[model samples]
Target: MTLTLTDETPPKGFERLVRAEDPASGLRALICIHSTALGPAAGGCRMWNYARWDDARHDVQRLAEGMTYKNAMADLGLGGGKSVILGDAKRDKTPELFRAFGRAINALNGSYYTAEDVGTSPADIAQAATETPYAVGLEGGQYGSGDPSPFTAEGVFQCLRVGAKHVFGSEDLTGRQVLVQGLGHVGMSLAEKLHAAGAALIVTDIDQAALDRAARGLGATVIAPDQVFATQMDIFAPCALGAVLNDTTGPQLTAKLICGAANNQLAHPGIAGALHARGIRYLPDYVVNAGGIISVAGEIHKAGPGYRRDRLAGIAGRVDAMLTRAEQEDRNTTEIAADMVKEILASANRNVA
Candidate 1:
């Protein structure tokens, strides 16, 4: 296993970036620490089959920075960092790779902590934890937070409820048309929640089994992935990858309210404005999808029992407050949420100075 720290100039607000490789295990990964303002940098390690090394680096940087704002806005009192392992998750997962990545994390001391993100699981985290104690989201431990997807789904569901109340004048989701684009673990969980709330579900995903499962179990109407943007629906929950609401898709969306568990949903800041221009209540992804991080943070802080539950429930209240603030200021929810995070980060920096 070989670990390398980058000599390239770190991005603005980034503290460090490092790479790790192991030919024997076919491990190739990069980790970025975006901040240590509130506390130790904490985020998830995502595995992907990126087209290039630069693509992975760019993803890690954006994800790490997003985590900084996410943790801040969620009031988790933790800093932000993220890591990415470039490979096909299904084909390349190995205990050896995660262990090697664990060593890379150990090199950072406790300045950063990692949990499971896209293409990763508690099993992977457990493998990494064997090499270092810096990893969270493990199973069978005192502070273990396990899989964060369900927690994440719960947060999104609650926020979606409040958003529905704001837009539809009622929290009731009964008979509401909802499109769930992506049926991953988190997406499926959110779909189930919405279905239980009596929302008519339209689902799409790359996995046929996932689509079929939702069709059979949740009675969700499966739509082709290409048809997602054009679908007319009351709510569009993008639980898939980031940047789905870019320049093109923003105009195609027919949903009045948007909420989901995906991180960094907006491709750019201006997309938020575009959604607002269309009168869409685009709830900030960081604020509504913070349950997973809040759960992992419980493990990082070694919290007592019930900490995760209480913290997860608080996300709904934050969404409520953010919506009200946005209305009062005549600004988009993304802007309002970003300002809230900036204020917290600035206060932490002031105290540090």
Candidate 2:
């Protein structure tokens, strides 16, 4: 089925949505540009075997909007955009396909910059860069930032400390029990950080190899993937796909704090309020996960690695300030973070006007 722009209303503040198909390469992709008020839109390109075209569209829309907020909050001088290519990552990737996708990005003329997201990698961005200069996160290049997963994990680790301090009255993770879902690159890196800090880890992943590796390498205990929410732990860190904190899992959550690297962790907007009502101090995903984009933006702008590392190191302080404000105002952290983004956007709009 061909993806079409229908009469249905677009997400509240999206600037543009492009659905494209390349018959030769069998590429079905959606690119969403949420805002360019601050600067050109920038986001990673995710490839997944979406169950439906609408699912891919929805993911792109939500993720792109989140990038807008993320970049704004990070003061990156970048707007928000995202691209999704529909396919099984393990089987469908081809040089021709990504090259074609690169052409599509180039056609945007820098309005949208693509990097690696879930099921995509820095190497894949390198492949795409063979055709477009806008591709980033490539390895070993002058401006290449390489894989950003480790940096992302570092930011999340810092945010976890901030949450610990706010909720448990200490910034230490020592002796804390953390349940980490999805042992992917970011998850594994985060697990290592937590383990090094003397945190007890309960981890789960769909891939047995990854699960075993985490268990053996990090001394983490293994749990069934579906049983994560029911497990008693101080922190539930979702490093996997989005929407894990949905209707089904919300009520079963045993964690006092929810902080992770997953974008759009809430299945619905209401999940934030629900978590808040349960006294779960939810760290906004974008706020915690902005490290990757911050690194990518710095690389693209020729900022040194030291500069990027400095910024990533500051994520905890930024998150702590937001969390403090949320507590003082008696508001959900998600709301507080969104208001911060909105204020930045408003300021940008005023400057442009």
Candidate 3:
């Protein structure tokens, strides 16, 4: 169930912890990097039934590193780390398993903190807290502290506006035909913003309830989840899993811009060149989808007592600026935005050094 490929590079400050209790219930965590340059590393734990252990390991490593860059780019004073549970969410989810994972993290003291992500929820985080006090996003009866999907979607929405301005001449979403490839929590939240902007929405989701919700509430036109490969729209928003822009789908895309909350949109590194060839403006995932982490980081650091909404609204403005700078520099938005973030981190590193 648990598979790992050891490498020397190990992603700067990588730490892998595995707790084997039985063949069926093993917990594995990979903390890809430490941002002692900033502060304690904090991130969400993603639980999924990856087909292979290598797949889960790869996902954890890449996502953890992405979180580091995302936090640095968003000016969050926190490092990045991620946890992955290798099992089916529906059938394999047990409080015991989560508790085991929490104990594993507890052993690390506070080097890597955990929250809710993907298949994990607030209740699961609460279960995790039963073992480790480091877990966040607890339910205190009022509004839950977990489920940061809407915040993530809001950030992506802002980034999309910036992309629209760069690709077209306007930042408004009105009259834009936006095709959303995933109807998950983030995608659905983003759909509300697109609808509010008077954009024509084309939605796709494997979950019928989510599709129905989008159709009934947002008046969005639902499409088969796989049909996004051939959908014709100004923007192709991928809010779900990563690596959708592979060789097979990249060449056939009709969207002028590809900007969304999904991480690692390119199936491979060369896909960027291919998207560049197609004139598709690619917004780097970490830069665009950082609102959730920013919010959680604020909570974690006690940055402020209030102003959460205003802080979130500011992400849109920053995204818009990044988009404008990319067009003015005549470079791919992904490269430009990522380079800016790298410069910031490099500066931070130098000051520390």
Q: Residue 195 of model 2: what lDDT?
A: 94
RMSD of each: 2.4, 3.4, 4.0
List the candidates ranked by lDDT, beginning with the highest.
Answer: 1, 2, 3
Q: After superposing candidate 2, which stretches have Cα over 4 Å from the reference?
A: 1-12, 21-24, 49-56, 87-92
* Candidate 1 error regions (>4 Å): 1-8, 21-27, 49-53, 86-93
Q: Pick the lDDT winner.
A: 1
**Per-model TM-score versus the true fold:** 0.90, 0.89, 0.84
**Tens digit per residue, CA lDDT, model 1, 1-353:** 35555545668779988877777778888989899999999999999999999999899998999899889877787999999999999999989888888888888889999988889988898899888999998886688887778988988999999999999999999999999988998999999999999999999999999999999999999999999987889999999988898888889899999998776788989999888877899998888889888888888889975787777767888888888998888889888888888888999999999
**Tens-place lDDT digits, model 3, residues 1-353:** 23232332454455443322333445544444445466667788888888876787688877777777777777776777777877777878888778777776676678777888878888888888898877887656333355677778877887788778878889888889999888877888888999999999999988999999999999999988778877789988998888988999899899988878887788887887778767888878877788778667756665552444665666666667776776687666667767776787788889989
Q: Which 10 consecutive residues of model 2 have the lowest summed lDDT?
A: 1-10
Measured by TM-score, the strongest candidate is 1
Residue pairs clashing in model 3 are none
Clashing pairs in 2: none
